[model samples]
Target: MSGQAQSPAKPPPELSTSDASGTVSAVAGTLNGLPEDPQMTPLAPPRSTPPSKIPLRPRKIQKLSSDNLKPSMTNLSASAPKPPSSKKNRADARRSSSDALAVVIPRVAARSLSCEGEVETALRHLCAVDPLLVPLIEVHPPPNFDTFHSPFLALTKSILYQQLAYKAGTSIYSRFVALCGGEHGVVPEAVLSLNPQQLRQIGISGRKASYLHDLARKYQNGILSDSSIVNMDDKSLFTMLTMVNGIGSWSVHMFMIFSLHRPDVLPINDLGVRKGVQMLYGLEELPKPSQMDHLCEKWRPYRSVASWYLWRLSEAKGGPSGVASAMAATGVSVQHHQHQLQQPLPPPTEEQQQQLVDPINSILNLGYSEFHFSS
Candidate 1:
């Protein structure tokens, strides 16, 4: 056996199962003796502890007194986290809130002169006050005064129409408006920009151009303004506008009645108004301008409306104006004028004929040939 030289040295024999188990236990004990790695350590299940009772104590929550006080930013981040929101959702929320506010608010509001109920009330008042006006009211549809023209613009147009026939005045006004940019563009600056020669070129006379310039300068100087004109009382307005070169009391009255739709203007100087008065009362001669205020006392507070009917009366052929004829047409009995139409009335004087064209010089006293306009 010693000579088995060539045979490799005998190797250690393999361990038995019992011996291997003991060796594995020794290795495991060596591993337990070493320090445990924190990351590599397996977590143990949480241990169940016995419940403890907390003693109740009452305390008031401290309230923040200052409006400027804010919660801590650190607490905000640490508290329950919210899921991210999209921009569209935030916009939708804002839009819904705005829509709710819109529904809660009102849309239409009452506006000046927009109340038709006022018109009905005025009509009822008129019918109750004057029996003659009742027929007129029933025969005609109610007057619809929806338009409110700027006083400045109306004054400008009235300036162009002064002392001229309707057609001639209209043509001149169109040309004048063209010179300035348009009707809407007829402001003080535009009128002032054009010289007397330029205005004359547009069919405005030299005198009328001077008048327009004077009006423009007054506006530029702040002595007269749209607001001032509109706010002025009737007497004060008559005085102020008459100070302008071409504007007169007659023109002011006409403007107040037609342009401003003033409720109680009586154009005593107006020829048509006088003629209407003559026919309404069946007078032998036209009533003097001085007597007009006394004769038409019943038409107060609605004199402008009465004046409108009066103008229609002069154009009518027979009866107590057209309004009475309208009453007769509606089955109401009209007390006809008992005065017979004998000889044809003499032609009106040259002064009276001039009144047909001249607005300012139309006021006349009975038997007086000429009358001057006073502010």
Candidate 2:
């Protein structure tokens, strides 16, 4: 207790003991709650006395076998049970399926006028729908398509006849046939064999020779064939034919009605048809081509027959000025032209005939003239 401040006494060292009976030794100091020596290592609290009843080892994860993974019979019966469909739903599904099929399938060609009894059927239908046509139908013999020519020959003749007078067209066609050896030899190969010079020598203009060559080339290339032409639908045939150099929509209409004998074709652009419609209905001005479809809507399915009658009607003895007089005999009233009846309509000149029958020729001629001038 002097001013030197003496240190406190240290604790006694731990005493260790061993037993000969093989029991664990104990450290007396540690049992008495003395701190362990700093230099000595400590024992981990006797590894949490593992439960005497060992904890069940977690079960191992295993993949399920396919047999065990299969759906139960009860589940199969419960899942995807089809709801009952009404008749309307079934019909709608069928209709939609048919519509889808129609999109992929090409249209079948319709029966032509040449089919047996078709003319008679058309005549009866026309008479029933249009009383004004009865007289014309009776006056003119029914059209016969039995003499239909091969598509190549017919097309060749059409090209030759375009815009020419009857005599001139006939002369050119005769010469052309002779050049090809005969009508029987007017195949695509024979036509293609003829040079432009030879065609020109036969009185064919350079433009016409070019048109013929184009048609022949298309045929030779298999772009067109007689069988395909015969089997094609009217619209398909028309579209394909007009792809030829000189064949126009007007020519296609004429070919469809006369050559192919299509049952339902109306020459909406034909001057004769327009004039006939005007006279038949007694209109002051000619009917526009745009209005033809509506005005002649009643002539569907038998429009080709009606058109034939119109051609005859327009060229009948009295003509435009005397439609009233001529139609009066047929019991068709044309009161609009009653006053003009006394004035005879002069016979159509060659130019007028070409205009009415082959208007495309005139347009081609105009084009040819411009081409000539430009050249």
Candidate models: Cα lDDT each: 0.62, 0.69
Candidate 2 residue-wise lDDT, 1-375, digit = tens: 588768878887554432311122225446778654544444433445656875589778898999888889887778875543888877888898899999998632336776788888888888988888887787766654444466677677778877665457667878999998998898888988988899998889888988898999998898988778777877899899999999888877766766666789988887778888998899999899999999998877789889867866775644422212223322334453343233445765664555453323212111000111110
In terms of TM-score, which candidate is strongest?
2
Model 1: lDDT to the true structure:
0.62
Give the C-alpha miss distance for residue 180 in model 1, angstroms: 1.0
For model 2, the superposed segments whose C-alpha errors exceed 4 Å read: 1-110, 317-345, 349-351, 358-375
The runs of at least 3 residues in candidate 1 whose Cα sits more than 4 Å from the true structure, single-residue gaps closed, are 1-120, 318-375
TM-score against truth, every candidate:
0.55, 0.59
Give candidate 2's root-mean-square deviation (CA, Å).
Answer: 14.5
- Provide C-alpha RMSD values for all models, in order: 20.0, 14.5
Residue 131 in model 1: lDDT = 69
Per-residue lDDT of candidate 1, residues 252-369 (tens digit)? 8866755555567788887768887887677999889999999887665677667755654453433223222222322334343212222223343455444443322111100100
